[model samples]
Target chain A: MRFAEAWRVALDALRANRMRSALTMLGVIIGVASVVVLVAIGTGAKREVERQVEGLGSNLLVVVPGRIDIGSAPAVSRLDLADVDAVSRVVGDPSRVAVTVASGETVRAGRRSDFTTVQGVLETTPAVFTRRLGRGSYLTASDVDTSRRVAVLGAAVAGALFGDRDPIGQQVSIAGVRFRVIGVFAPLGQSLGVDRDDEVHIPVTAAHRLYGTQRIDGIAVKAPDRERIDDLGARIVAELTRRHPDTEFSAVTQQQILGVLGDILGVLTGVLAAIAGISLLVGGVGVSNIMLVSVRERTREIGLRKAVGARPRDIGLQFLLEAVLLTSIGGVTGMALGVGAALTADALSPVPAAITWWSLALAFGVSAAVGIVFGVVPAQRAGRLDPVVALRAE
Target chain B: MATPAIEAVDVSRTYQLDGVSVPALRGVTLTVAAGDYVAVIGPSGSGKSTLMHLLGGLDRPTGGRLVLGGREVGSLTPPELATLRNETIGFVFQAFHLLPRTSAVDNVALPLVYRGIGARQRRERAAAVLGRVGLGHRLHHRPNQLSGGEQQRVAIARALVTDPTVLLADEPTGNLDTVNGQAVLALLEELNTESGVALVMVTHDNEVAARARRRITMRDGVVVADSAADDPPADSAAVPDGPAAGGDADPTAGDGTERAEAAR
Candidate 1:
């Protein structure tokens, strides 16, 4: 038979049992839609994390005491202010170096008090990191040299301590010491699950006195150029290791961190897509089952057509076409539904969703293939039916 | 003689049911020529339907050669046999076996689909044949929408649409009322005479068998008699009878007293 004619017959059969056709398509619809939606969610999350990582700064390198690699325990870290000076000489840009020590402390300003994270930082903090002041002047190098009791408040800390009140000239007590708030950082929300806006910054020398610790937590350095980042990290780690032979230091670049994170998210996306594919497999089986039932129901019709003139191949093609049609239509509908759902979820909630064309194409191709894989036995059954027995079937 | 529309030489068929051998046609020999009208009458389970299937190339004989339109059925592959059936034979069943939801014209056009005819021409030919069967006005009516007689006429039109040399109709009038049966029977006779297509019908009704130019009677997996055997097979390719021969048809048309006439 002509190809168009075969399609016409298949179409007629579906139209003849519209309710059955739609019900059979439901399984594939859900399967493809879930795959698209879930993959979108995974892609959206990976992108969000990338944006956050990139937001830290350009050509940024972090040097920490000890090995952060798997299967290695970190040695007791002894990185102090003198080590920071050694790192500054290695980079040849002292203004690009910054150190930090973090502790949770309670701050009292008049009648209002807030428990917040207090960080020790240098005057080069804003230069090495992408931070801005919303009010007042930031800490100066003289303030760190004098061990002055001055502080920079984060946007949230300032709000909590002095609700909409200008905090530049105000006094707040931190770790039981009175300090003047020198500045308030801009409204940066959250990064890597930590509230960036709810912290206070003090001079490194003053923090050491308050916390009774001579060790700094970590160091961040900005490389002069992107191409020298890896070399710069290695040089810094070598210098730190040179100063304290007993302690090992590791310097990590942003790219390496992103690679690790991207690998993790890629696996997550694949896993979610695979889980949704199980539903497609189930949907394929449903198509096969429905095709079998259709063959059984149309046995007499098959007999009649064969008696007139249809070859076994023609009959087989008809049934196979029916199955393919069912899945392809369902696949398209599912894609629309999944895209709509993903966009809706992205818009209404914090969960990010991005619809990638590859995911859509993969879902469509697999759904069609599912029809073929699941449709074969039933179509063969229809073609192989004995006209004699089939004609006699009630 | 025009390659004999069908020739079965001692064709025998045995079916296996759960390892039990049951013979349906025990070496029955027959020949049906082009432009012939023959009726086969027998009770149920008598191998009459089996004979029709073998004659139409729907089944293979176990014992002898069966040639359809000058091609040996045994030598043809299943697909080749299907094509042969499509080219040379058409069928009408007692159930009126029309695709239930399709319009009459489309149902009639079905046979031509396997012939690779385009849609427009298929429909045109189908409509022309349906008009000849007195159903020109019911071209768009589905089976459920049409009366029983109209449905049977549509089936007849489908059979004739292929322009086959032989039309194998198994109990063509069995599913209709008395009036519809008479109408269907008359239409079959008319199409047979008007188109000169060979007609081979299997019927339980004796009166329906009597209108044919020849009659074949089967019993117990064998053909016991054929009414026109006295005449040469080629001579039996006469035209079908007129409408006047319906009620007062020859009682001897199903004449089977000449027993064991076809182990030839």
Candidate 2:
């Protein structure tokens, strides 16, 4: 039979049972919609995590100054200038590497003083953290070596201390010692839950001298490239283990953090997709049920068509096509709804929502395949009907 | 000798109902020749419909050989049988089985569409055939919109659309009044005259049976009479409006030998 004729007949048959066909389509619609929405939400959460991770820079590695044991108290090894120089000379790929000596301290801007977590580092610390200077200068190696009390304020810190005015060359106090603000760091959104622009940075020696602390808390490192990250981390760990065999500190790499987050997101996406998949399975059942009812209702019509020279193949095609049409329509509508929902969520949320073309294609393709798989029984039943008995049926 | 248009040699149909075998037709042998108008007359439950079903290839005979148009009916597959029906035979039913939702023209165009005619040509052919049945004006009317006589006429038009060599009507006028029945009978006669298509009608009406040149009477799945109508008297004779009643004095009357000869 010609496709036009076949399509017309199938359409007519569906239209003949309008309520039943619409109800069947409703199953497909809900199934596709939920799958799309759930997938979008999952993808959105993943994108948010990626942005957070990116804010900290892909090559950045955090070195906490302690071996954290499950049942024992963590040992704090005060990170100091000697440790920073020793590690810098000990590590290979010196050109791509930068280090930081991190600690927390109290500071005051005039009468307004706040206890803020401060990172005391050399000039290269901004590059390691992927932070940029928005105003004055970053700490210099000269300042760190001379133990000068010059500070670079984070964007939030600058805003708190100076308001609308520039805080460069202004005096601020850390541990009751006056320091001059050199530069303001640019905004760096958020890393995990911590606002990146809220901390204050000063030279490592100056921070140690002013706070009367002779040690640094930890060091941060950045590798040149992704391929050398593990190599560099291993070298750092081997060197750290050698230098501080008694102190005990660990070097953490980006891959470990990325892998942990990936696993968590993978499970989250899996759980969400599985729940949505259940609805699709329910939709398939709906298609089967509706088609079964259609086959029963149109038994006489099938017989008549067969008697009138319609082949079994024609009958089968008609029913199968009906299901495909129904589900495909649902798939398309659901994609639109899903994309819409994702966009709406992204607009209203601080976290970003991601919609990919492949995701949309997957949603449609799966629905169509499901329709065909589920429609088979009904189509076969109609095709195999005996004309003698069918024609006799009321 | 030539083959009959339809031939049944010891044909039978049996059904198993609740493990009980009920024979609808039992070893019935009959022949219908080209250009012949034959009526199989019997009451309900007499197996007339069963014989019709067997002859039309709508079903298979449980026993014996059946041939239609010199082709062994049992040799054809279901699809082939459907094709045979589409091309070689047309059916009219007692209830005037027109698709309820379709226009009369569309119902008539069905066979042509099955034959794969283009839509435009199908409509034209259906219109022309409906015109032949005196229903040209009612072509667009649905079954519900048309009167009983009009519906039967549309059914006839549908049957004739395929231009089949044989028309099998199972009580074509069963649902119509006397005037409508006469009108349908007249249309069938006109087709038989104009096209020389063989016509087999099943009816319980003696008045209807009188119109056919030959009549086959059935009882208990057996043929009681395969005879002809009486000749009209020379003066003031009424040439029965349809088939003449009773079986005698008709030129098409059976001669045990001509039954064999008419097969030619």
Candidate 3:
């Protein structure tokens, strides 16, 4: 038989059993939809991590204090202001790096009070951290040199404390000491659940007196050229170890963090996709069962067709086409549903969800393969039927 | 001197039922030429249906050679036999075995489907055949919407759509009432006489059998009588009567004694 005629006949048969066809397609629909939605979420998480890592600035490396092992005992190691200055002197480029001494503190401004993070850094902190002021000017070299009690408020912190009021040049009490707000940072949306716009920035010397802490938490160094980031990171680690003789800190480049995050998210996506594939297997089995039943139900029709002149291969092709039609329709419907779900998730949650064309193509191909693989046995059975016996069947 | 439409020489068929061998046709031999209208008449177990099946290539004989349309039927492969059935012979069953939900046109077009004909050509040919069978106005009506006689006509149309050289029918009017049965018989007679297609019909009813120009009577898987060669009995002389003879024409038309006499 011609393919077009066979297709039309198959479609007619499916339409005759409308409810059964729809029910049979349900399993495949759910399977493909879940696969798409899960992959979208996985991709979304990976993208969010990349964005967060990118937010730190270009060619950036972070040096954080690590635990030191001594005689089989792990001891907490500290990175202080002296170690920061020693590392900077060894690197010999003071303009390319900035150090941050951070602590959580309670701040009060008039009738509003909230706990917020405070970071103490040099006047060049804005350039290194890729931050811009929405209001007043950033801290100047004189402000740091004179031990000035000036602060830069994050966008969220300023909103919380001043609420439509101008925050620049206003005095806010940090750890019970008054500090004048020098600027308000621009709005930077949250990434990975951490709001970047919810902190206050201050000069390093005044932070020491206010919080009574001499230790600097971490230091961020920018490569003079993008290609030198790894070498710069290695030099900082070597210099810090030489200065302290304890190997008490770890220098992590931005690419290292991104690589780790990518590996973890990739595995997560793969695992979710595998789990969703189980449903497709179940759907395939459902298709096989339904096809077997259809063959059994239409035995006399098969006999009639064979008696007229249909070759066994022709009958097999007809059934196979029917199975493929069912699955391809299910695949397309599931794709639409999955894209809608991903879009809905992106709108309702902070994390982004995305559907790629490759996933759609893969899902369609898998569904078609599933139909053919599962449809073979039933089609073969239909093809091998003895016309005499089939005609005799009621 | 074209080849006979069907030739059965000492054809034998056996059935295996629950591990026991039962013979359906015991070395029966017959030949039907093109454009001939032949009917086989017998009781239920006389193997008339089996002989029809063999003629239609629906089953192969266990012994002896059967040829259809100049091809050796027993030697052909399954697909080759299917092609023979499609192009050389057409079948009409007792049940008017039209596909239930399909329209008359599609049901008639079914045979052409296996011939690799496109749908439009198939439909056109099918419509032409249905028109020949006097079903042109009911082309789109499904089988259930048709009367018994009309459905049988559709089946005949399906059988003729491929324009086969022979038509094999097993009890073609067995399921219809008297009026519809006569109508189908009349249509078959017209097809045989006008279209010049060979017709081989299997029927136990003597009146239905007499409608054919020649009759073969069977008993216990063997042809006990053939009316073409020997003169039929006085009561069985109603063969010249038309289908208007209806159901109650003659009571002793195909009695066993007359059949015996006809065989002699």
Best by TM-score: 1
DockQ for each candidate?
0.64, 0.31, 0.51
Q: Against the correct fold, how does model 2 do in TM-score?
A: 0.79
Model 1: per-residue lDDT, tens digit, A1-394?
4577769878988888999999989999999999999999999999998888888888899999987774576556699999999999999989999999988999999989999989999999998989999989899999999999999999999999899789888899997899999899999888767788999999999999999999888999988889999999999999999999988788988888888889889999999999999999999999999999999999999988888877888889999999999999999999999999999999999999999999999999999999889988999999988888888889
Q: Give the fraction of native contacts in model 1.
A: 0.80
- Chain B TM-scores across candidates: 0.89, 0.84, 0.87
The number of clashing residue pairs in each candidate reads 0, 11, 0
Model 2 C-alpha lDDT per residue in residues B1-264, reported as the tens digit of each score: 345678889998998899999999888887777766888998889899889888877888888899987778888887788788878787887777677678999888877766778889999999999887777788889999998878988988888888887899888988987656666776676677557677999999887887787788888887767774233232123233433322232212123123323324
Task: Give the least accurate 10-residue stretch of model 2 chain B, judged by summed lDDT.
Answer: B248-257
Order of all candidates by lDDT, from best down to worst?
Answer: 1, 3, 2
Candidate 2 per-residue C-alpha lDDT over A296-393 given as tens digits, one digit per residue, 9 for 90 to 100: 88787677666666667777888888877777877888788878877887899764667778778888998898889988889988888877777777
Per-residue lDDT of B1-264 in model 1, one digit per residue for the tens? 567788999999999999998999999898887878899999999999999999988888888889998899988877788899888988888899999879999999998999999889999999999888778888999999998778988998898887899999989888887667766776776667667788899998998887778889999889988887866663454453453244333212121111112211
When summed lDDT is taken over every stretch of 10 residues in candidate 1 chain A, the lowest stretch is A68-77
Write model 3 residue lDDT over A210-252, tens digit each, in one string.
7777877788887777787777777778888877786566777
Error of 3 at A94 (Å): 1.7
iRMS of each prediction? 1.2, 2.0, 1.3
lDDT for model 2, please: 0.76
Q: List the residue pairs that clash in candidate 1.
A: none
